[model samples]
Target chain A: MSLELRGLSRRFDNAQALRDIALQVDGGEFVALLGPSGSGKTTLLRILAGLDFPDQGEVRIDGQDMAQVPARHRRIGFVFQHYALFRHMTVFENVAFGLRVRPRASRPPEAEIAARVRRLLERMQIAELERRLPEQISGGQRQRVALARALAIEPRLLLLDEPFGALDAEVRKGLRHWLRALHVELGLTSLFVTHDQDEAMELADRVAVMQAGRIVQFDTPARILDQPANGFVAGFIGQAQRFAGRLTSQELIFEGLPLAPLPRALLLGEAAAGAGQGPAEAFVRTHEWQATPGPGNAVLRSARAAGGRVQAVFAVGPALIEAEIPPGLLEPGETCQLDPLTARVFLADTPFATG
Target chain B: MTPRPAIAEPRWARIVLCVLALVLLGLFLVLPLAAVFTEALRRGWGPVWQALSDPDAIAAIELTLLVAAIAVPVNTIGGVAGAWCIAKFDFPGRALLLALIELPFSVSPVISGLVWVLLFGAHGWFGPWLQAHDLQIVFALPGLVLATLFVTFPFVARTLIPLMQEQGRSAEEAAATLGASGWQTFFRVTLPEIRWALLSGVLLCNARAMGEFGAVSVVSGHVRGETNTMPLHIEILYNEYQFVGAFAVAALLALLALVTLAAKALLERGGPRGSLAA
Candidate 1:
């Protein structure tokens, strides 16, 4: 199913949970709604599943308006964050729920239901746990059973709200790869919500970065990393050091120091034209800034080895900027020149300001 | 091996608290229970059995069981519906509705029966109309059922609301997305999740319905063989100076109470599986 959401908005008392959001996922494509907590990603996913209705707008699946369709009629398989498996049911019974609950006219035979459940359990590698209650299995196994249960009905679209959110780090990592492979194998249109950027980037064909109540940017992971639409996307998708600076006469100034030449076309573009050239913010990822020993440069305040790499924190005026450096390149209290290899500069008045 | 941690309280303090609890239990619970059995069997098992097998006493026992059978199931269904509304849906006046459901528990049982009498008695609001229609509500079976129903109304709902609220709506929503209807979701997901709590509530309701004295007494008109419940019957026998008979019947009620207590404990210990066990 090709999912499309247009002009979606929801409000809870004084807070706007979702606002004028729009997104699209092609058939058999995997998309991730990526955001921090309370960013309206979960709300958007719920609206798609018909579990929640948007205050205003339309959800269309393959050109059919879903406003009048109830959740049961949507045929959208949803996996909750905590893997809401029935506590009393065994793994096989939980997986067979959707099939068994079907209206008798369309329901499959008993033998067929059993065969399908067995096949799914085997495919999910949880055949041994078929007779075990959900509480008797590991969290990871429960997650698989949840997925198998959702898949039992052969839904047209799969919606997962943090499918691996409750598992341990090691288990989450394994499931991420497994889910990616499963999406490919099943060829089902899927949309998953997650706050983890790494998981989104690794698993999704495209990532829709949400903030507050809107979709801020929607693009491939590579594009989202290399060419973040604004400062928020740049800082949110990766470890970025933000500099409160401004664009002055074709030069980017950081703390009254001219750091690099700003692209002339970008400065003259519509984004900067609205701000009227007062002040701007720049976001530079850890690897985007190059640091080398030099005179009259930012002083290195600290150095620590992290994840098989060296991370050095530099004190540039009152601001602290972190950069990834090679081992043994910089020591604490040493001076180093900082150069921006890449940066995303947005006007201070823009909503994309990280601060 | 690691050394065990010290107890939170001092040893002397723990012993004092334990002794105090045991003393209270003995003075109030054990003494009363022992007195009932000792006094009932004072005339031996022959009189005790004869008192229980008396026609009026037998009628009271049958009437108590019948009332419980009717009242418990009715309240169980009502309570489940009320809990489903209060727990699953958010609407205007939800708090007010919950307060209404619990109104009977807070009101005096005498007041509960009096309210029914006021509605259906001779000079009360609905009395003239009821008399004109030749329908008897007060001082009848309907009045007794109503009083019992009102008093036990909150038990099942009160037991379920907190539990269902804690479980939340995620599982039901997941079931809906998987193509289960509202009824199917309730039966397959919601019911199983709350089965033990529901059973516990039903047991409590049944116990209260069977043991109810104040409300049933007010509404029963003391009609010995026809309207009197077990508790009312025990009171009549005691007031008539039939000590052995009253104590025998009291022993039966006490046994029922114990059975209710045991069932409640069992249900609580073996309640729904913990959602986060794994």
Candidate 2:
């Protein structure tokens, strides 16, 4: 089902947890709420699930206002970050909990519940673990149980809070891919929260980038990568170095590096290209930049050849950033010409901008 | 072979600590318990059986059991509710409620009983109103039950709050999102999760309610076969020089304590699974 949120804000005593958040999710869509910790993405998910309430705003599922609905009545599934499985119950019982807890009039028969639970266990590929308690299963298997439990109620929207955050790196990759396939297989609309940018970019159809309790940008992963809303998104999403420079109507000049000013129109957009703004900053993703052995902008700290390709670490002033350098071009401690093929520069202060 | 850990305690220190702990347990626990049983049987099996069959002793046992039956379940329900409020939800005065639930622990047991007297005694706060209504409480079974309930009020709640807090509200939240109502989530999820700790709390509450002396004495009025609990009955028998009877009652209390300990340990070893378990 489609979900829409408008003007959602929640405050806990002195600190604001969420701020005027608004988003619309189409049915059967895979969305990612990508943000660092304490950015309020999880809080947003909780509010939508009716586990928490917004201090002021509206949440609608299929155009029904959700203010009066309780969490249990909302039928919005939530899988916790730590896999909140019932420790006392076996995997099958955990999956059966939702169905069994329904009111007597609507509750299914025991045989039906068992059949349904067994089917779900088989679908989760954890049929053998049905008799084992949550503690007996591996972390990955426990998450699968949690997911099956949430799905038992046939919820319209599934919300996962860092579902793979606790697993090892290799396991997290396999699970996310498997989860994505399951989402499509079941035609389930899911919104998962994660701080891992690569996970969001790799798994989500559209990512809502959040920072400091607000959604800064909501777009496709490629658009968010190519045209970030501000400097934070650009720096946060990709491997890059941040550098400040002066911008005149005709030329762009660096503050510390000895690089020549290029024409102003060369940057991404011409909307605010001819700038007369001072102290503008830009982030060039490592893949967007090329480096050669010559004195230009940045100093190469180290270069090593691995798997027949040279990868280098460059120092742009105090910060060290990595990029794939052309093979055999630069040595350690040598200055290089770091050229950004297509840079997006925003002026110092006409709009909301950052370093 | 796997290498030995570097952080293991030295052999001498470990041995000394273990010996010391065993010695302390024997001295403080085993000796006193053995003394009660030995003293009860000193006058032979006849006096011990006679003491056990005494009408006053039987009355005391009945009264103590009744008080525990009333107090333990009430306290368990109250404690679980209080712990649920303190652990699962945030509200105004939450910390204050937690501190207040522990008030019995800080207050002396005599004071806990005396407060009831101050409220229900003939000349105390609600005393006149109760008297006019032809109701008796301060020096009766109700008084004994109240005093025991007062002293043991914190057992279940104190045991549960920290465990519940450590277990967290996530499980309940998960159950709720799965379409479980409040009671369903609690009975199905929270209660089972905390069952071992809950059982221990009830066992402790029952023990204290049956064995309570200081508070029950203040409110009991020493009404022999009527209001006297097990501890009060033992005191009266000891003061009256009925050594065998007093020792017999003490042995029973000690047995109860041992049973509680055994049950507690058994529950822990075979407790519910997970690190977030009770």
Per-model CA lDDT versus the true structure: 0.87, 0.86
- Highest DockQ: give the candidate number: 2
Task: Let me know the TM-score candidate 1 reaches against the reference structure.
Answer: 0.94
What TM-score would every model get versus the actual structure? 0.94, 0.95
- Which residue pairs clash within candidate 2? none
- Per-residue lDDT, model 1, residue A342, is 57
In Å, candidate 2's interface RMSD is 0.6
Segments in model 2 whose C-alpha atoms lie over 4 Å from true places: A269-276, A294-298, A306-308, A315-321, A350-355, B1-10, B273-278
lDDT of 1 by residue, A71-162 (tens): 99988898999998988899999999999999999999999999999999998999999999988899999999999999998999999999
Deviation of model 1 at A179, angstroms: 0.8
Mind listing the fnat for each candidate?
0.92, 0.98
List model 1 lDDT by residue over B37-132, tens digit each: 899999899999999999999999999998899999999999999999999999999999999999998989999899989899998999999999
